[model samples]
Target: MTTSDGEAKGEGIHAWHRQAVNDPNPQTLTATSAGHARRRPDHLAVICEGREVTYAELHRRSNQTAHALLAEGLRRGARVAYLGRESEHYFEIALGCAKSGTVLVPVNWRLTSREVDHILRDSDAEVLFAEREFRPVADRLRPVLPGLRTVIEMDTPGSLADGFLDWRAGHAETDLDPGTGRDDAVVQMYTSGTTGLPKGVVLAHRTYFTLMEHMTRAGLNWYDWHPEDRSMSCFSSLHSAGMGWFMVGFAAGCTNVVMRMFVPEEAVKRVHEDGVTVMQAAPAMLRMLLAEPGATPDAFASLRKMIYGGSAIAPPLLRQCMERLDCDLAQMYAAAESGSVVTCLAPAEHTPDNPRLGSVGLPCPGNEVRIVGRDGEVLPAGRVGQIHARTPALFIEYWHQPEATREALVDGWLCMPDAGYLDDDGYLFVLDRLDDAIIVAGQNIYPAEVEMALAEHPAVAESAVVGVPDQRWGQAVKAAVVFHTDQRATARDLMVFLRGRIADFKIPTQYDFVDDLPRNPTGKVLRRMLRAQA
Candidate 1:
C-alpha cells in the first residue's frame, strides 16, 4: 500500500489515525450521527416532505434500527438493499447499516425489474427495505430470491406484518457498538458498466471520513460546510453524487433537505422555502431548474454555493447559472471508485472568461492525478490519455469480481473509466469516456469537445455525437442535434460555427435533426443508444 505521493501508506495522519491524535471528531460513518447528536440534540438533521428529524431523534432511531437488524440475525458484512426514493427512512437505514456493520445497497427506482432482480441476486442481499412505490416489484422478486429472507416496507405495511416504523420501534434504542473498523465495508453501490452489466463497488467506512478530514485539516475551502447551512440532496442516493454529498452534510453536522426526486419546480421551491444554502446538482438538472419560470435570482438568493458535476456543462449554461443564481459556483470531478471528490474547480477560479474554465480545476489536498499511456507508462502534461487517480478515500474492490478489480486498481492507482489529461498547471481536462471516443483515420476524436463547440452556437440546444463506418476514413463523425424552440440553424451553419472552434476533421459530416437527446436517469447522454440509431 502506498500514498498518492509514493510515500508509505500511513506515513502521514489519516482519518482513522485522527483518533490516535486525541481528536474529538468522528472517524467513521456511524459516528457522524452519534457525534452530532451529543453536540446539538434539537438541531434538525434531516427535513423531507414536511417531516423533520432532529440529530438526537435520528441517533436514537438509528440505534433502534441497528438493534432491529441484529435481532433479525443479520451479521456484520451482510448485504441490506433499499429500493425506494430518498426519505428520512433511507438515511435512518443507512446509518443503521453503518452502526450494525452491515453493507447497504441502494437500488435505483428507475431500473427495470430484471435489473433489480440481477442486483438483488448478485449481491446475495438478505434483507430488503422497500418504499410503497416499489412494493409491487419487491413482492414479485421476493419469492424468487431464495437468499432474500426479509422485506421491510418503507411507506406502509405490505408483505411484512409490520411497517418500517413499527418494526424499528419494536427494537430497543440502546446504542450498541459492533466493533466495526474503519477498514470494514459499509456500502456497496452497483455501477452499470459499458456492457450494461452492473458491478458492485465496495466502499469502506474510512472512504467517507479520511479524505474529508484530510482536506479540512489541509484548510481547503473549495466548498465549506457550516452548522447553519442547509444542503439539499437532489441527486438519487443510488448514485455516488447523491450519497456522497448526503454523507458530507451529515459529517459536517448541517441540516440536510432530502428530495424524493428532482423536479425542477419542486427544487426551486425548496431552495426558496427551505432556505437551502448549499446544493449539489448535475448540469442537466441545473439547466432544467434555470428554465423554470419561478427560477428568478431571488429564488436562488439563499444559496451560498452551487456545486455541479456528473457530466460536462456547456459554457453557455454555466454562464447562465452564474448570472441568474448570483452565488459561488464550484465543479467536482470524481468517480464512485474514488470514494470522494478528487478535483474541484473552486469558486475563486469561476470567472466566465477564464480559459481554465475548460479544466476541472486542481486536485484536492493529499490526492494525486496522472495520465497514463496505453503501455501503462505516465504521460507528460497536456497530453490526453487514461486518467489514473490515487487518493486515501477509494473503494476497496469491486464486490466479488477480483479480475475486474485487478484491472481497475493497479499499483495503488485507480484507473478511471474516462479519458482525460493533466495541464501543466496541474488542472485536469476530461475529454470523454474511453468507450465513447471515436477513432477517425487513426486519430482520436472526443464527442464532448465537439458538443461543447456546438453549444456555443445560439441555435444549438443539445447534441450527441457518434462514429459511423466510413469506407475511406475508417469512421466518420455524425451528430444528432436538437435546436432551441425559438432558434434554428442549417447543417452548413453549424459546420461553419465549429470550423475554427475545433479541427476540421472532427466536425460532423452528417447531422440528424431531432427534438431531444436520450439520457439515462442521472442525465448522462446515452451515446450507445445514439450509436445504434446511427
Candidate 2:
C-alpha cells in the first residue's frame, strides 16, 4: 500500500516519516554555492588557516578551475581525482568540477599507491590533484595511470607543493555552467572496501542539494544555518560527511573553518579560537577530544551543536558529553550509498532516561527509514529486521557495478542490509550489518551488540567481533579486543562481564586481546580482517 502521494506507506511505516518520503523539494547541488555566490558575493565561504575565500572570489576561482579542466581536453562526465586533505584548493576544484560537468573522485589519501592506482585507473580519471604530502606516491602512480594526463600539486599552508595555483591561475575566471541537472553525476567516492576491492559510489547534485531543500521545506532547524555560523570541516573529504557537510554549509553561505586533518588538540583550539558555532565528529575523535587536557565546557562554549556518527556512542561517554559540552547532541546515522540522514538522534531525544539513547533516531526530512522482515514485508515497531531507507540523497549508481546496485537499490528504496528496528516512537536502533551478522547453530547473533556490551567494561578500550568457522556450531563468535593502557583484564573476565549483557550464545567463543583492531580511514572496525585471522 502507498500513501495518497504515492510514497510507500502502510501499517509498518511511521507517520513521522511519511511527510519526508511522500513529498520532497529537490534541487541541483550546484545551486547551493552558485545561489549564494551571486546573491551574497561578499560573504566569507571558506577559511583554511591563513587563507580566506569569499563567495565571489571562490565563484571566480572555481570558474577558472573549470575552464582549466575543459581546456585540458576533458569532456562532460570525465573523471578528476583528488588525493589529499581538505583545503581551499580542494573545495574550489571540487566545486569547479561540478560547474564543468565533470565528476570529482575523492581517493582516500591513506590508501597505498597501489590501491590509489586502482581507483585512478578504475575511475579513468584524466586529471589528478595532490597535496605536497602525497607527492612521492602520486609520482609513483603516473605510469600505472595511463589516462591521467595532468597531475597538479596543490601548495597547502604550512606544508610542502607545485603547479596547482599556477595551473588554476593560467585560465580565465569566466563562468562555465555546463547545465548539469539535478540527477547528473557530480561526485564519485570509493567505499572503504572491507571484503574486496573498493567500489566507487556515484552521487549527483540532487543527492546533495535536493535533500537540503526538502529538509528546509520541512522546517528542520538543523538544516538551517545561522548568520555567523562557522563549521569545523575536520572529516576527510573522501567520506560522505566530509564533502556533504561542506556543501550544505556553502548552500547556506556559512563560513567553514577548514582543518587539514583531525588532531585532537588542534581541533579543540580551532573551536575556541575560531569561535566555531557548529561541528561534527566521529565517536573516536570525540573521545580523544574529551580526554584532551585542554577540553572543557569553556573551550566548547561557542558550539551550539555537535553532530556525530560512524558508530554507536557509548552511554557513559554520552552522559559525560551532555553534561560537560553543554550543547545539543545529534547522533546521526548515514552511509556512503544513502548519504547522511538515514536517521538522527536529535537533541530533544538525548534525555538521560530515554531508553532509545543508543538509537540512530528518526528519519530526516524527505526520507523514510523502515525495517523489513525476511519475507520482504515492512515490520512493525520493535520488530527486528533489515533497515531499509528511501531518500533522494542516494547515489546515482555504483561505478561499473550494475548487479550490486540493482540488488541494493530496490523499488525506490536504498535497502541498506543493516539489521535494526524502529521503536513505537520511531527511534531506530541499529543492530549490525547484515553481512556482519553471525549465524551460530541457525540462531542469529549481532557482533555490534556484543561489542557494545564489552565496551561498557572499564578495562575494555575497543574491540572488533567476527564470525569464524566452528564444527560444533557451524559458525562461532570471536572477538579481538584492545584494552586500555594500564588496565587489566582476561578473556575469562570479559566473558563473565558479558554474561548478563547479551545472550550466552552471542558471547565470543574465542578472544584475542590485541593492541588494536584494524580500522578504515573512517574508524569503522575491519571485522573482515579479524575473520581472515581466525
Candidate 3:
C-alpha cells in the first residue's frame, strides 16, 4: 500500500488495522455510565481516598447532576466549567455534563485567578462547579465574567454542602438523557499554547469511542482493560491524557483507584495496599515513584503494565522504570487534539539494548502518520519533518478559533507541532517540538536529542535544554541541570562527556545548577519558562 505521493505507506495502514471483534461498542461518552450501570451495577467504579462509588451510584449521582444542570437553566451544548482538583465529584460533573449535552471544561487548579478567568471567559461557561478551597477565586471572577451564571461550591467529602451537594440532591436521580450524539462535544479542554494563553480544544464523544473501538479491534495488548483490573488515575483531569485514561477505565467497567494528588510515597503505599493492576503515568512521575524508599518489586508486584508519556523520556529513566518496577512498560506519544496515544511503544519492545527503544513505535490501528516538510511536501523515509497524523479520534476544533482550527487541521490531518522522522519499518523517532528547536549556525538543534546526551552523564539527575540569545550565532544552547543528591558534576565535566555524544553545537555553551526544572501540573517540562529565565 502507498500514500497519495506514491510512497510506501507506514505500518499504520496495514491490512489488520481494520479488524474488529464482535463486542458491543459505546456510541457516546455518556455510555461510560449508561453502558456500565447496566452491566456492573454493584461493582466499584471509582475509589478515591477513603471514598468509594459503585457503578449504580455513579449513574444515579451523575444523573442527579445532569438534572440539576438543566434545572439551573443551562441549555444543551452550553459550556460547564469545573475548577478544582480531581475527586469523585469531578467525575460526576464530567459525566453529568456529558449526559446533559453540556461541554465539560476542566480548569487547572494551579492556574492563577487571572488565568482561570481567561479560560472561563474564553469558554463562555455558564455553570461553574468549584471546590470550597477555590470558591474565593471563583467569586472574584464571577462579576467580571458575565457569562458565568452559576457558581456551585463543592464541599469536602461527607460534609453537607450548602452549595454543590445540596443543589445536586434537590434534583431527581432518575436517568435524564439530553439526546447527546456521537458528534456532540463532551469536553472543551484548554491547552497552553506558545502565546501562553489557553486555547480550548473541543473533543467530541466520538473522540473517545473511535479510539476505543480501534484499540479494541486491533486486539493490541499495549492498552487493554478488564473489569477486575484496578487502574490508577494519578494525573489531573485537566490534562487530556488523564481524562482519557479515566474514561477508558470507566468504559471498560474497571475499578479506578483515584489519587487526589501524585505523592510518590503515597502512591507506593496505595499500589501495595490496593492491588492496583494497571496504570498510566508520566516518566517524571515514574522516576519519583522509583525514588521512594518503599518502592520495591513487592510494592508494584500486582502492577502488570505501566503506560507512560507526556514528554520525551530519557533512556536512563526508561531503563530505570523497566528494571526497578519490573513490569511491562508501554510508552505512548500523543496530543490532546489527536485523541490519545496515536503511536505507542508496546511492552514487548521494551528490550534492554534494542535501538527501537529510541523510537515511539508504529502507529496504532485506524491512525496514519506522515512526515511533511516546510513546503508542505511529504518527506520520504528517514527524513526529518513535521509529524502529522490522520486519526479517527481527532478533536472537533479549537473553540471559536477558526483560523487556528484551519491551521491545525490541514487536509484532514491533525498537525502536531513536533519534528520527527519515520524509519523504513515505520517507527517514529521524535526529535522534539519544532518550535523548541535551537537554530545555531544554520544547524537545527533539538533539545530532546541534547538532553538525551546529558542523561548519559552519571551525576546528572534531570536537565532541561533551551536556546539563549547568542551575539554571534543568533541562538546558543543552554541547559539547566539538577544533580543527584549524593553526586555532583561541573559544567566542564558535562560538556566533556557530551562532546562525542551529540553534535558539538548542540552541546550547551552555558549551564545553570538548579534544584529542579520547572514543570506544569502534568509533569511536562516548561521549556518556555527555562528560556525566559535564560
Candidate 4:
C-alpha cells in the first residue's frame, strides 16, 4: 500500500504506529497482572455459562495461551484459525494471537465442515485452535490442509480425541515480542458470502486505532467510560463489529462481559444481574428481547447505551424499544472493509420526534459519503443512488483478489454496492441493495419497501422480499414471512395489507409462509437462499 494524499494516508495512522513502536501500551498484554495494574484486577471481565473470569484471570490465561502458541514455533504474521462457538476461550485465544503479533482468523462456527475447510485453505492457516466438539470435523480436513502445522484442542485433558495437542497445558508463560504498528495486520475477517464465496478482509492495527479515534471525536461519547463501567457483547468476535467494539471497551478500562450464546431471557438477566452499562447486539436480538414475557423497562434499567445494527430496524420496533427499554438506543452502519462503523445515529437523535427515524444518521468525521448514479455522476439530495465512501479506516485490499480489489475501489473510494440516498439534512437512508432491485415494466422497485410494509403487520414477526424471474413483467416481487406465533395467514390477506400501504407494482406477486426465514449468523437475511427456494 503506497502512501499518497488521494491514496489513503493519514496522520492518525502514522501517529498510532509511532506510539506502538516507541512505548507499547502495557494493556496490550493479555494477562491478569496487567489488568490489575490498571485498577481492580479481581473485577469481572467475562461472564458465560454461569461462570465468570475476572480481568486478572482472563489476562493471565490469555498470556499463557500466547506462550503456548509461541512454543509451537508460530511466527508473526502466521494465520491461525479460531474455530468454536462463543466462549470465554474465544476472547483468550483472540487476544493471545494479538499479543503474539500473529494474525487472528476467526471462523464462524455456524458454517459446515466444508465451508470451514474452504476458509482454512483460503487463509493458508498454519495452526487451528478448535473446541473439542468440533474435533471430528477438524480431523476429517487435516489431511487436506497441507500447510497446517498444529491443532490445539480447547478442552480439558481426556476430553479431546487421541491425535491433538491439549491447548491448556505444557507451555511456560514466556514473553514474546509484540509487533504493534500501522503495518502489522491484527485480524482477518471473512465476508458474509451473501453475494458469493467469502473473501478474507485484512485489518491492521492502525485501522482499529483510527476507528476508535473517529468514534470518540464524532460523538460516540466513549471517553466518558470508566473502570466501573460494565460492558456486554453478544456479537461474535469473528466479525469486525464484535471484536472491534469489545476492544474499544477494553481500551477504556471497562469490565467486559461475554455471552456464550444469545438467549433473549439470559441476556436480560445478565444485564440486570451484571449491572451492565453498555451493550451491543443485532436488531433481531433486540426484537427477541422485547418480545419475551415480563420484559419491561426495569429489565434494561442498568443499561446506559444500547447499540444496534447489522440489519435494518423497522420503525415500529425502534419506537417500541424507545418506549419500553427506557435506554438510549444508538444505530451504527458499517462494513468489514470500513473497519466497523462509518455512520451512527447518536443516542440523543433516537427520539420519537426525530424525523429521520429510519435513517442511518450522518457520516463520521474524516469520512466522505456520496450517492452516485450508474454513470459515476454524483446525485443530489433525496435522489436514490449507489452509496460510496472514502475513509482512513478502509482496508488495504481483499487478500489475493486483485480483480475484486480493483472493481470495489475507485479513486480511493469504496463503491459500497448498497443503494440509498442522503437527505437534505445530510442524514443517509439506505433503500436496498443495488443488485436486489427489481425492474418491472421499466420501473425500479426495491424489496426493502415491501419488507418494511409487511413488518408493520402485528402478525408478521420478520420478513424478506426478493425479485424472481417473470416472463410477463420481466421480474416479479416475492415475499417470505415468519410469523410471531403458530398462527397462519393467507397470501391474499398480506397482499391486501400491502395494497393499502404501497403502490400496486411494488406489492408481492407471490408470498410464501415458512417456519422461519434463512439468515446468516449476523442476522442478515440471505435473499439468494430465499430466491433459490422460490
Candidate 5:
C-alpha cells in the first residue's frame, strides 16, 4: 500500500482519502464472525491465561453466548454490565452482547465497589457478568442496585454462587439472531471527568467500524497478521484503547495474550516466552519495564510493534525505548469521545534522526484537525490553541448529557478542550489539557510545556505542574516532581534552570519533590490530585 500526502484537493478536500471511506453496516457479532471466518477460520483469535481460542471457536462461543442471553429473556437494547479483569471470555461476551442488540458496559476492574455500583445504577444494567475474584464486591453492592436483576458468575460450574447464574451452564450451542445495524450502541464506556463523576461514552457499531477502518488504512495490516502472532494488552478493556485495539486484533484473527494484571517482570517474560509480536501499553508501563533490573534489548526481541500513548512520552524515555526495544514504536493520540486512534506517529518517525521528534504526527487520512482560539477563530500554523477535529468516528454524544454534548459538538466538529498547535507540516504538538492551564501573573502557562522542560533535567524522572492558590500572583505555578535514583534538586535550582528556558513568569514558584506522581492506569497525570494536595 502506498501512503498519500493527505492533502486536500478541490472538492474532495474534506474526505479522508486513505481511510476505508465506505460506511460499513452496524457490525453485529455475526458480521464480525463472518469477516473472521472469511479471512482466517483456523487462525487463533485469543489466548487468555495459556488457553487458546481459534477464530472459528470464538465465533461458535459468541453465538452460544448470544443464544444464552436470549434464552434468559434478555430483550433487545437491555444494558448488560461486564465486570472483570481482562480475559478471553470478555471479548466473546462483548461481541455477543453487541450481536444481541444489548449494550455492553465493561466496568474498570480497578474501580472500587462504590464506583462499580454507580456505573451499574447509572447505566441501568439489567444483568451483570462478573468474575469470581470480584464476587465479594459485587455481592456487597448487589442489594443496593435496584436495577440489577441477576448476576452471572464467570467461573466453573461448581464454583458459582448459590443464587447467581453460572456462565458455563448458560452457554447454548445455538446461533442467535443478529439484530440491528451500524448505528446501534454496542458499548458504553465510563470515563472519569474533572468534576469527579464518571460519564458514559456511547459508541455505536458504525463509529467503531469507522475507527477500525481508519486504523487499517493507517497501516494496521489485518491480513498480514498470523494466527500465531502473540499479542498482549495490559490496559483494561474498559478504556477506549484497550477495547478498540483488542477488537482490531480479534478482527485480524491474531492470538490475544491476556494479562489479568500488569506486572512489569511478568509482561517482559510473556513477550520473550510467548513470541509476542504486538504490545500496547502506557508510558508508565514502559518506564517500569525499562527500570527493571538487568532488563535487556533481547527481552522484547519478539515484538514487532510497541504502541505507546494515553499521555505524552518524554523525549529521553522515547529515545531509550527506541534503543532498547527491537521493534517498531508507534504513538497513538485519541480520546474516548473520538472512539479510538485519530492521529498516529508512524514507525519511521520514531527514529532519532526524524525532525518531528515531539510531534504526534499528521492528522488521520479521513480526519480534519484545526487549532482554534477561545472565540472559535482558527489559528495559523505554530500558534497554540484548542484542538478541534471532525471525523465520522466521533462519538454520537455524551450519554444523557445533551447540554454538554451541544457544547462539545459545533458545526459537526468536536471541539476538544486540549491545548496544542499544528506545525507548518501539519504535525500536531499537544501542550496540555485546557482545564489544567495555569495563569501566573496574567500569563497563561501550560503544565505540559513546563513538565516537558523539567523532564529534560537529568535528575527528574517525572513531573506534574499545577496552579496553586497564591496571594500576590493570584495563582502560582507549582511543580510536583519525582527524581531518578534518589537524585535531588532544590526548588530554587529548578526555577533558575527553567527561567533560562522559558519566561520568568512561567517558571515554577514552588516544588514538592516526591518518589512518584499520581496518575491513572493509562499513564495520564491526574492534575486534580496535585491540586488536592496543594
Candidate 6:
C-alpha cells in the first residue's frame, strides 16, 4: 500500500488491476488507435458538429494525411503546426502525423500573428494546417516562417490549394512502417515564457498513455476511459486537456463528441443529445452549463464521471456541480511540461463532509511529487513550497532551449514554480497563485510576460500584472502601472497596445494607475504586496 519511496498509499486503489503499466517496447499512439480500427472498424469513433466519423474511416483518412505529409518531404520528427479549433480533421491530422513520425503542434487560434509567428519559428514547423478564419494570420506568418512551405487549410470556401480535403485526396493510405521509437517527440506545446518569449515543451507519444496505464495497474478507476463511454471534449484544442483527453478517448475506442469551439449552451446540449458519459470540463464551463436556461439536474443525469481541474474551484460551486450533474467528480492537477495528469482527486473523497475536498486529492500512480523548500530540502506535510514532480511523462526538453531546459529540468524531475503543500493524508493543495502565472479560462498567462508586453508602449514607465479572482474565467488579469510623468496614456490605450503584442486572455481585463510600485530593500517589485492590495 505504498509507493516506491515508501510513502503511505493515498487511495490504496492500486489493487484493482494486476497487470503492469510499462512495456518492453513502447511506441506512438497510431499503433493503439489502429488496433481499435482493425478490431472494431464499424464503431462510431468521432462525432463532431453533427457528423459521425467511424474508427475505420478515421484510420484510413489519417493514413492518407500521413501519406500527404510524406509526399511534401516531411521526415521523421518534423514539426507540423495546426492552427484551428477542435474537429475530425484535427484528430485525423494528429494521428496521421504520428503515423508519419511527425510532431503535431496545436497553436491557440486566439493568438495574434506575432504570437503564432513566434511558435512556428521556434518549433521550426515546416507545415501548417489552418482553418479559413485564420487565413489572414497565416498569410502574415508566411513571410516570417521561411521554412514553412506547406499550408493546408481545413474547412475552406476557396480552391483545392487552400483546403485540406483536396490535399489529402491526392494521396493513398500509407502502410509504410515509419519505425518510430517510444522516445521520439510527437507533440510540442508552448508554455508562455517567463522570459520575453514562450518555450515549447517537447513531449513524446508515450506521455499520452504512461500515467493512465500506471494508474490502471495501481487499480485507479478514474485515470482511464471505457470503450462504451461517450466522451465530450469542449476545451480549446491548443491546451493539454483538449488534445490529451481526445487521444486518451481514441485509444479507449470510445466515441468522442468534439466541439469546434466551446459555446456553453451548445456544449450542454451536446452532452444531453450525445448521451455523454464522461467529460473533461473546466469549472467555468461547468458553472455556465448549470446556469443555462432550462438546464435542470436531469439534463446532466446521464453523465457518469466529470474530470475538471486547472483553476481552483470554490467549495460551494464544486459541491453544486457534483449535485447538479449527479455524477462522481474527479479533480486532476498537471501542466504542459509535466506531460500528463500527475495528481488525481478521486470521486470517493468529494463528499460535503469530507475535509479532503479542499485538496487536489492524492498523487496518482507512477509519479513522484514533493514540496521542496528554499534550501532544496523536501518540506514536511502542511508546509507550502514549490512542487517538484519526477515522472516518465515529463517533457523530453524545452525545444531548442538547452539553458532553459537545464534550468527547469534538473536530473529527471521537472522542478515546477507552482507552490503547494501535501498533508499527512497525502492530499495536495495547489494554491491559486501558481508562481505569478495567471490562469484565465485554463490558459496560463505569466505576469512577467504580460508586464513585458505592457512596457512596450512608450507612455508606460513600469507595470505590474496580477491575477484577481473572477467568477467566470476563474482568474482575470489586472495591471497596476506608474506612467512616465510627461506622457499621457489611458487604461484603454495601454490595453489596446498590449492586445497587439500578447494573446487576448493574457491582456489585463482591468487596470490601475499608480504613482509608484512597492519594492523591497533589494528593489525587486513586491508582487505579494501588490496581491495583498488587489
Candidate 5: segments with Cα more than 4 A from true spot: 1-29, 156-165, 168-171, 212-228
- The true-versus-predicted C-alpha distance at residue 510 of model 2, in Å, is 2.4
Distance from true location, Cα of 284 in model 1, Å = 0.6
Rank candidates by TM-score, best first: 3, 1, 2, 5, 4, 6
TM per model? 0.94, 0.91, 0.94, 0.89, 0.90, 0.79
**What is the lDDT for 59 in model 3?**
95
User: Which of the two candidates, 2 or 5, achieves a greater TM-score against the reference?
Assistant: 2
lDDT of each: 0.85, 0.80, 0.83, 0.76, 0.76, 0.77
Question: Mind giving the per-residue lDDT tens digits that candidate 2 earns over 1-534?
Answer: 222232332332222223333544435545556666787788888888758899988888888889999999899999999998777888888988998899999988888666787898889999989887787777887887788898888775644333687787778987666878778999998987776678899998766655555654564554346657888756777788878888767765788888878889999998998888878888877888988888978899999888888787766678878888877777888888996578777777777998888888888877898889999999999899999999877888888889999988999788886899888988899998888999999999988888888889999877888999999999999999888789979989989999988999999879998987788877778888888888
Deviating ranges (above 4 Å) for candidate 2? 1-26, 156-162
Backbone clash pairs in model 4 (N, Cα, C under 3 Å; residues 3+ apart or in different chains), count = 5
Q: What residue runs in model 1 are displaced by over 4 Å at the alpha carbon?
A: 1-26, 157-162, 192-194
lDDT agreement of model 6 with the native: 0.77
lDDT of 4 by residue, 56-100 (tens): 676667677778777778888888898877677787787778777
* Model 5 clashing-pair count: 3
Q: Which portions of model 3 miss their true places by more than 4 Å?
A: 1-26, 156-162
Stretches > 4 Å off in candidate 4? 1-40, 157-170, 218-224, 486-488
Judge candidate 1 at residue 194 and give its lDDT: 41
Model 2 residue 454 lDDT score: 86
Candidate 3, TM-score vs. the true structure? 0.94
Query: What clash count goes with each model?
Result: 0, 1, 0, 5, 3, 1
